[model samples]
Target: MRAYIVPMARSLTVALAQYVPLNGPDEVEVLRSSAAEMCSAAPGLDLIVFPEIHLCGDGDDAPDTNEWLNAAAEPLAGPRQRALCRVAADLGVWLIPGSVPELGDDGRVYNTAIVVDRRGDLVAYYRKVFPWRPHETWAPGHDFTVFDIPGIGRGGLSICYDAWFPESTRSLAWMGAEFVVNVVKTTGSDRAQERILARANAITNQVFMLSVNAAGPVGAGGSLVSDPEGTVIADLPSDEPGLAIVEIDLDDVTRVRQHGTEGLNRMWSQMLPGDPLIDLPVYSGHIDPATWRPRGQS
Candidate 1:
C-alpha cells in the first residue's frame, strides 16, 4: 500500500474539557459554561475537545426513552450548533463540541460529532459508527471520516463505544490520520478499560489518541491523551470536572512510524492477497455446515 503524506505541524497544544452534563432546560447553558471554562484555561491551545452527548445529558437514567432522546436531537443548522460555532470563533480555537444526538433528514437520530474551525465554520463531522449495543437507541453511521487541521496535521473523530473496535482507529490511521479524538460518556467502571484501549490504539497505529470523557454520575470523567508511543501524557481526575492540556508534536507520529518495530508503514506495504481475515463464506450464507471447526477440536 502506498503511504500518503499529510502535512505535519511542529507542535500543537490541545485541551480536553472533562465536565458533568446537566439535564433539564439548563443543559445547553451548562455546556456553554464548560466551553467558556475550557477557553479560559487554554487560551492558546490549537484544539479543544468536549465530551460525547454534551448538549443533552447521556440518557442513562433519564425519563422517556425514545421520545426524550429524539426530542433532544437537532439538525446541524440548529441554534445549539450555531452557539457551538460561535464559541469556537469567539475563542479563536479549533473545537470538537463532541458528539450530539443529531436528528437526520430520514427522521432517525444519530450520534454525530461535529468539528469547527477557528472561524466557526463547520469543517467536518463523523457520526458514531458503533453505538453501545442493546442500550443505545441512536442509529449507527456507515462511513469513516477524517479531516485536516491547517497547522496541526490530520485528525479523525470517534464517539464513545467506537473505541472498543480497533478497526475504527486503524481505519483512520490507514487514511493518513495523524491523530484520533474519541469523545465519550461512560460510567466510572468502564473508564479504565477505555483508557487502556485508547493507549493501545495509539501505539498500534503510531498516532496520537485523545480520549475526552464526561464527568459526574452519568459519566466517568477519566479524560486522557496518549502519545504515539502509547504514553499517557495528560489525564484528568475521574470524579471531578476539570481540564487537561498537553502539547504534542505531529513529527512524533512520523518518528514512531519510521523507527518503531515492524513499523505501520512497513506492515501495510507487506500485506499479501489473503493477509486480511474478513468475512467467511459460512457467515455470508455461502457455506452449508461442518466446513470449519476449532483448530484442535476436530
Candidate 2:
C-alpha cells in the first residue's frame, strides 16, 4: 500500500528596517535601540534586515571614497560589531545588520555583510563580490555565501551592487538558497532599475528576493520583496523611514521549482545527465549537465 505524505509549511517572518542612520559615534547604539523597539512592536519576527552600510554613512556626500573608508572602516569582529550581536540575542531574532567596511587581515577594506543568529552568534558573513566599479573602493570578495535557518530554510546574502550581476543570485540559488537577502544603499536614480532587477532575480532563480534599502537622508529607499513567481508582495517606495513586516512561505520555492513557473517554464529541469556540457568562453568554464542541481543533491 502506498501512502501519501503531507508536506510541512516553511514560513518565515521578516522585518525590513528602512531607517536613516545617525552616522555618528552612537550609530551602533541607535541600531540596537531601534531594533529593540521594532521587536517590541512586531513580536515573533524570524529575521530583521537593514540596508547596506547601515553602520557607516552611505557615502553620497563624501568627496573621497578612500578617505571615507579610512575614517569608518573597522576590523572583522570589531568591538562595535560584537556589541551589535547582543541585539539579536536579546530580541531572540535573527539579524542582518547590513554591510560594513571591514578592515581585512590583508590590510585591505572589504564591504562585508554579517549574519547573526538568535543565540547572538555570528553565523556567516559575505563580502561584496561585485563592488560598484570606479566608484566603490572596497576590495571584492570571490565567493558566494548561503546560510541555513535551522528548520525554516536557507538564505543567500548579497550586497548592493552585487545584484547587478545575475550570476550572483544564480550561483546562490544553485547552492540551495530558498531566499536571498540583498541589502542596498542606492542614493542614485538607478533605484528604479534595481527594483526591476529584484523581481527578475526572484523569478529567474525561483527564490524569494528580499531587497532592502536604506531610507532617505541617506538612500533613495525603494526596497521591495518579490515572491518566487516574480510577484511584488510588499514595496516601500519612498525616502521616508519605515518598516515592512512580511511573512513568506519558503515551501513556495520548492513548489515553483518542482512545477513550472505559472505552469509554463521548468528552467531548472531542462538540464539532464545524458546531455553534453555547454561551453562558455567568457568565464572559461562549462556547465556540467550531470550536476547542475543545487548543492548536496545527486
Candidate 3:
C-alpha cells in the first residue's frame, strides 16, 4: 500500500483596512501612504480592500449628497483614481480602493468601486446597484460584477446595501465567484443585522464573504470575514480603526460545496436535473434545471 498526498493549498492573503477616511484634497495621498505602509508591514499581501465611499468619507452630512458629491466626486479617468491604481502596481498587490463617488459623463454621480490587479491595470468597476434608498441619491447600477485572481480564485464586488438583497450574492456565486467582497461604510444601528447577513450569505452561497466596514467618525466599524461554512473566521471591533488580516483557502469553498457544509447539507446538490423549473415571479425568472448548480458544476 502507498500513501497519497494532496497538492498545496490555494490560499489568498487579504487585508481589510478598516480605517477612518481622510476626506480632503490630499485623500488620495493618504490612501497611497496607508497602502504602502500596509504592504511594507505585510509582505505578499494578495489583496487590500477599503470601505465604501472611503474617498468621500461620510458626505451624507451635507445638505444633500449632491452637495458633497460636487466637491469630492471625480471622474473615473481623474488623477486621483489613476494614482490609486499606480499604488497597486508599484506595490505588486491587488487593491480595491473601496467605493468612490464617480462623476459620470451623464452628469450624474455614482457610488462606484474599482478593482486594480497586481499589474496596476483597472480591470473592473462596479457601480452600486441597490443604493441605500431615500438616503443615497447616486444613480443605481444595472449589473453585477466579478473578477478573477489568476491562480487564486474568482471574486465578486458588492457595496454596503447590496448585501441586503440575497439575489446579489446568489447571482455572483452562480457566475463562478469563489468569494464576494462587500465593501461597507455602515454608521447606522443596522450593522448588527448586516453581520448576520454576511454569514448567511456565505453559508447559502457556499462562498467566502468579506464585509469590510469603515471606522471612527465616518462608520461604526465591525468588519468581518466569513468562511464557506458560515464560520466567522475574523472580525474587528466597533467605532475604531482596525485591520483584519485573513488568509482564506479557496479549496475550502470547493470542499464545502462537494462534501456538504457540515458533511450533511449540500444546498446546491439538492437540485437535480429531473427537478422542475422553479418560477420566481418577483424577478420574472425561473430556476432552470440545466443551470441550477454552481457555474462549472452545471
TM-score of each: 0.83, 0.95, 0.94
Model 3 reaches what TM-score against the true structure? 0.94
The superposed Cα distance between candidate 2 and the true structure at residue 133, in angstroms, equals 1.1
Decide which is better by TM-score, 1 or 3: 3
lDDT of 1 by residue, 1-298 (tens): 5465555557888888887765667665666676677777767778888888876764555676556778888898888888888878887888887888898888889999999998999999888999998888789999888988875688889898999998799878877888899999887597888889999999777789999988876788888888988888998856588888899888877766655533444333343444444455653643213322111111
Model 2 segments more than 4 A misplaced: 1-6, 58-65, 296-298
| Total clashes in model 3, counting residue pairs 3 or more apart in sequence or in different chains | 0
lDDT value for model 1: 0.79
Across residues 234-259, which tens digit of lDDT does each residue of candidate 3 receive? 99957789988889999888888877
- Candidate 2 structure quality by residue, lDDT tens digits, 1-298: 5333437989999999997755676787888888888888888889999999887763545787567865678887788678878888888999999988888889888999999999999999999999998878888999999999999999999998889999999999999999999999898899999999999999998999999998987788999999999999989999899899999999888878877688667778889768999998899999998778877433
What is the RMSD, in Å, between candidate 3 and the native fold over all Cα?
A: 2.4
Minimal lDDT window, size 10, model 1: 288-297
What are the Cα lDDT values of the candidates? Answer: 0.79, 0.88, 0.88
